[model samples]
Target: MLVLIGGAAGTIAFDLFGRAISPILGFASLNPIGLARGFLGTLGLPNSGAYGHLMHLLFVGLLAYPIGWLFVARPVFSRVLVGLHWAFASAAYGVGLWVFAIGGIAWFAGNPAFLGFAPIAWVALVAHVLYSVVTAATINYIERLQHAR
Candidate 1:
């Protein structure tokens, strides 16, 4: 469905920024695969590279995160932040994801909390926002197309 497509698009954006753009810009890059692997390790699960790929790409990026955006985040924010644009709200959701996944989960995965507020943490922040923005844009575009039909 469109949701899945949006999610996949966003995930690709996240990876592109984290792996290519951030590093080229002199910031530490994000490795979602490693993070997923470490998180699985923390949970006493398989933590193989294959498993990490599945967890990050299939589960979190393509399913849970998008559902969270459409169901939980948008609804809550629309109510609380009347008149705020969806893109900004999506960016806020990205920040929340960074807090939960990076700040909190990464710690359990053995990285310093918030990367000890290091440069990488800021880079990660931008990546997260980019992910959400792309996701919202994709979904919006799809919906608008459908409505136009």
Candidate 2:
């Protein structure tokens, strides 16, 4: 599914970008997946290593699934309108994820990588935007394929 693909891709992309600036920025690893892992830890799951990261990816992909479903797909040939809708919806959704993850989850989990008043915030903003756009595009592509079939 597009959600699974997009979420995984987004995580990799976000990690890559984060790694690039982290050394110069002296920032901690912006482990978005760890947000979910931390919650599981609090619940006595004690996830670690690849398992924890996989859980995080699955969590992200699952959450993204319904979002992609909600957008659905516009009529075929309405490329511009569909693009506009995807853009708007994805942007809003991305921002919501950023806020929820950074402002809510990270805050509660005591992870310092995603808080405000820092350069990482800016990087995260861009990363999230990229994520949403990719999610939208992937879902749209799948929908178009389904329609063609």
Candidate 3:
């Protein structure tokens, strides 16, 4: 149960940080509502933006929790999981930064609407790293607890 909760928390933290950063980086329109609406439309659920958000959140929770539990149950696999986690996290951060830089450059190069929010982007990047680190630590701790039992 604790592992499940931790995974859910991690997923929420990750998505929250991503949402915050995307707007500030200018990669996404600042309107979350419109974004949600469009996302829902893509899934054939045209008037269910709220439901779409909920489903996305649920998907994250489901993916993370089982992965977390698996890591906890198999200590030998924990190291591999941690390595993959870092690789995945770094790739995500790198992509986000690249997108932000491109947008900033485009905006400065005469696309007046492409302005980037560097500060917010930086904050979001930091948040994502923090989240990954914390999740890794929590998984390690959980592994230890399981082993001790």
Name the top lDDT candidate.
1
Q: Report the lDDT tens digits of candidate 3 across residue range 52-118.
A: 4554455434354335334543344345566555435433433443354334433433433223444
Cα deviation at 128, candidate 3, in Å, is: 2.6
Q: Each prediction's TM-score against the native? A: 0.96, 0.68, 0.45
Off by over 4 Å in 2: 20-29, 62-84, 112-114
Clash count, candidate 1: 0
Model 1 stretches astray by more than 4 angstroms: none
Local error of candidate 1 at residue 19 (angstroms): 0.2
Q: Which candidate is the best by TM-score?
A: 1
The TM-score, computed over Cα atoms with residue i paired to residue i, of candidate 1 is 0.96
Which of 2 and 3 is the better model by lDDT? 2
